[model samples]
Target chain A: MVRQKVLLIKVGELKDLFRKLFVVILFLTAFLFIMLSRFDSVAIEALNKVVIKVTGPVMQVVELPARVIHHVWTYFYDISHIYAENQLLRDENKQMMILQNKVRTLEVENQLLSRLLNYVPPAEASFMSAQVVAESGDKFTHLLLIYVGNEAVKKGQIVMGDESVIGRIDTVSPPYAKVILITDINSKIPVVVERTRVRGILSGNNKDLPQLIFMRSTTDVQEGDIVVTSGVGGMFPAGLPIGFIGSINGNRVEVEPMADLSRVEYVRIVDYGLAPDAELSVDFVESEQNAR
Target chain B: MRDNWRENLKLFAVHRIPLIATLMMVFLFFMPINSVQINYFRPVVGIICVYYWSLTRGYIFGFFSAFLVGLIIDIYSSLPVGVNVMIMMLLVWTTDWLRKYFSMSSFGVNWLAFAIICTAFLLLKWAFLSLYFHHLLPLAGSGLGLLSTVMFYPLIAYINALIARKFLPQERIDE
Candidate 1:
């Protein structure tokens, strides 16, 4: 009613309303905060509840196409494996002989080993297949959602792609899980060169690869030096594959992710078990990105 | 009596649209969908309907309903709390305010306004969530996202307007 009367009043009287507008905006914001605080998690929780329900069916609908294709593919593979192992090896030997002029995969491994042997840890990481239900590459945080929840996964479980380690499961929602992708700028991992073991902080920088900062000036990092999680920070299991160090510019090292974000499917989550970790001990060595 | 039944049915949908959108979100997030099918369609549809109603009829949505829409998006999308709700509320208020001032007699004005409103809302949501997670995530994929959203806006906006026209009536807001 006050607003109605103010509207009916002359334009000159509205000048007072400017001061009132400021007050109203402040009051509105305050009211919002009050309402939000009162409800606790009502808003986000309410929305997520609905979305999960609605999308539940849509997700089912989406599954049909992939499931059909996968079934067909499995059938084909099953038929091919009908032969015994000796026969299969004999048949493949002929195939390999014909393709003997093919490019050698060992050559690549040898090159990789020479560059990485210095820092390579003997620990082999395991993988568990998971489907992404959510993907947040929102710059502030890069998170991926997996279909496996608490029933299938636990906290501190290491999530990795085919090529390298992603991030640990920070939080798990029932029926759906959130994967904090290593590329999220806030993700901090203790990593060292797979060749030199010159330890540094593997921090996400809103780019595909995290930046390796605070490498010793004498670090043996090169353009393609492999980078792996040092497990120096107890968050990730030590020596899981992280990424390969990209071009090394002085003490600063940029990394290109071994795991491809595009066409990423079937993530492997290692059931690293629930070991409570205190605050990380590795120092956040002040680096160039922070200097900026 | 028949008309009353029809009206009741219509009302059910209006209120349930949020619920329906909420359900759609759950399906998207909770259940496993193959990566090939994931799209922003659900969130886009929910916000568009909410936006349409808020602009044409602000009385029905109220602040709480708008806030609910945001909360829904956050949950289904697994975003930080209060972020999407804040964006939805801002969109509703801005759209409602513009409807009062601009003679949206033409579709072009409505379309342009929708573009601007959606852009602001998306940008704001990204900004806030980014700040909150900035310390934890490396801010990857931020720069390319704006481009995709702009391209997606026209497609989603057209479909949104269509959905709004099909389901929402001009009288629904005034009432």
Candidate 2:
């Protein structure tokens, strides 16, 4: 009986040792993964894609209850404000009618001038709408997983919310893609002040407002000036409205994104085909046109 | 013999309750609530699960289960790969070490212990991320997340305890 007891104790000790060793190994493996991710390896990307493909459907299923609740709450809120909204829209619509006529005249004059100059128009952007299926709602990161549904969305393609630029596609797995929002720390976009044309790099700090950096010392940048994509990098097209400069303290300028990123339910994945290597092949373009 | 086999299968299913619960919490963490306040102050549900399970059902939940929970969170989270994994594993290790005190203590004492441990975990995460990016990240986000998680512990723990009492076998609960 004593011998059996001793053997049991020995076995327990061995098991405890094994558990400790396993924990150490797990810690090391996790650190190794963090290191591998820094290099942005293809293996890690492939692993991410496989995981996302499996979990994307699960996320959609889990999100149904939340979606229903949100819609119900929004319905009541909208009903409460419907009268005021209608009045506002009527005022905006009358102004838009006047602007529409002026814009039409300008469009005809611009077309005639382009014909005389023999100008080749830039490739028109094609877009597909996607519903946000999941969000990284933690304090540390701001990313959204959108259901692409077999539409070809490549990494670095621009994602727009409502009427303005919100983010770019960070990863694309078939049927799902991840958007790194402009408020995420990893986001960086080259932009120019619309009024003075002073260019700067907009950097996200994981805050509501992303800060503009790298502008010249003497650059005249004012609060409330519009910021647009500078097209310095081929990744984004020129003149895409990003946001308005909300504040300036010395060299630090913060931009408040035009899109209410918090309430984004649907987004447009635009293929500007602006990247040097991102141009669609003539056959693909023709097929797209035919399909359209 | 057939009845014995069926009993063993039932036990096996019961044993997985903690893991399944933790996985569900992970899904909840990623749910798109779309409220700015909720988004910024979201609790670290996975950490809470790891801590609670490791403290109460260490033999069943195990380090491997904690690792798996962390891996799932890492896959879903936009933070650098393995950050959550490392944090979860550390939580398991710490909870395992302090399980005796935590198990013997009252709920308030256990919560205090968790609050201290969770604060350290979030700070470590914040420090690691700041180093990774080579910039000082704003700490208010981590501060708020920690506050949310600490405040949320009792509710989640209560739910977990109820699940354990209902579904888990007495032997596992005693362990």
Candidate 3:
């Protein structure tokens, strides 16, 4: 009886030791993981790929009920206002038709001017359409998971909603890719003022309106000037509509993005190959050879 | 011998409640409510599950289960790997420790304790992320998150109580 009692005590002590050891290991593991991921280790990337690939489809299935409910509510809301909306559309169509004709005439003239100047337009990029699956964060981080995987999608490709730039593909796993919204704290885009061609850096402040930085103090930028990608980095193509200047607080200008991030349901991803700097260097070499 | 086998089966069936509860909470976490304000105020429903199971059924719910649930949340929410893992494990440990001193019979006390725990959790999360990102993120979101978590605590607790009564009724009475 004494031996049995001693054996039980020994087992209990061993269990207690194991539990303490396990907790220590967990703490170490978590700390090490956060540190490794902050530096963006390769192992973590591979593991993220595996996790996202498996979870992508499962999350879509899990979110179906919520999506269905949202769609139903939208349908009812749309039906309730269809008559008024139809009347508004009729008025909009008449205005748009007049604007369309004016735009077409200007486009023809601009094409002629460009042809005469020997300006070769950038190659047209093909777009792959994807449905946004789910959003993963709250106020601090804005990330969206799209249904397309790495097979058809590449990192750094621009994602657009309704012909306006929304974000870029930051990471992709098989069967899923994450789009980092332009309003995310980490996002930065090179943009230019449409009216003055003044270049500036559009930096996200984790708010609805991202801040425009590095504009020249003597620049002709105004509160309502349209901003478009400058294609300076070769990462994104030039001429994609980004947003408009919303407010100017001192030298800090805010941009209200053309794409409504909160209401984004689908997006088009376009791969614009290489930055404009590469073309500039090529043109410089050709001009030097002609001079020689 | 047959009676013993049946009893074991029954025990196995009843013991799955904790795991089911964890999964149900995860499902609730991902259910999008479509309003930005509501989304910002998204409750940490999984934390409630972790606390509830740790307090009521600590025997079956352990650190590893918490770790697994946390890992899943991290992946689903695109949070850095191991962020949620560490937090959930800490929750299990703290709740396990507190359960020793605090009895589950008083609902009011448990609810108040949860409010405190949830507030601490949001502050800890803010600190950890700020340290990781090497920037000072504003605490507005954290405050809203805490408020939402506290507001949703009663409803989540009620649902969990219902789940416990229906599935793990035999286990709850043992306390």
What's the DockQ for every one of the candidates?
Answer: 0.26, 0.68, 0.44
Per-residue lDDT tens digits for candidate 2, residues A29-89, read 8988899878865667787899889877876776678778888999999999999999999
lDDT of 1 by residue, B87-111 (tens): 7666766876787765456756765
Where is model 3 more than 4 Å wrong at Cα? A149-151, A216-220, A273-292, B1-17, B172-175
Chain A TM-scores, all candidates?
0.58, 0.88, 0.86
Model 1 chain B lowest lDDT segment of ten: B33-42
Question: Docking quality tier of candidate 2?
Answer: medium
At residue A90, candidate 3 shows an lDDT of 100
Clashing pairs in 2: none
Quote each prediction's TM-score.
0.66, 0.91, 0.87
Ordered list by TM-score, greatest first: 2, 3, 1
Runs off by more than 4 Å, candidate 1: A1-127, A137-140, A149-152, A273-292, B1-10, B18-53, B56-62, B76-79, B118-144, B173-175
The DockQ-based order of candidates, best leading, equals 2, 3, 1
Name the top DockQ candidate: 2
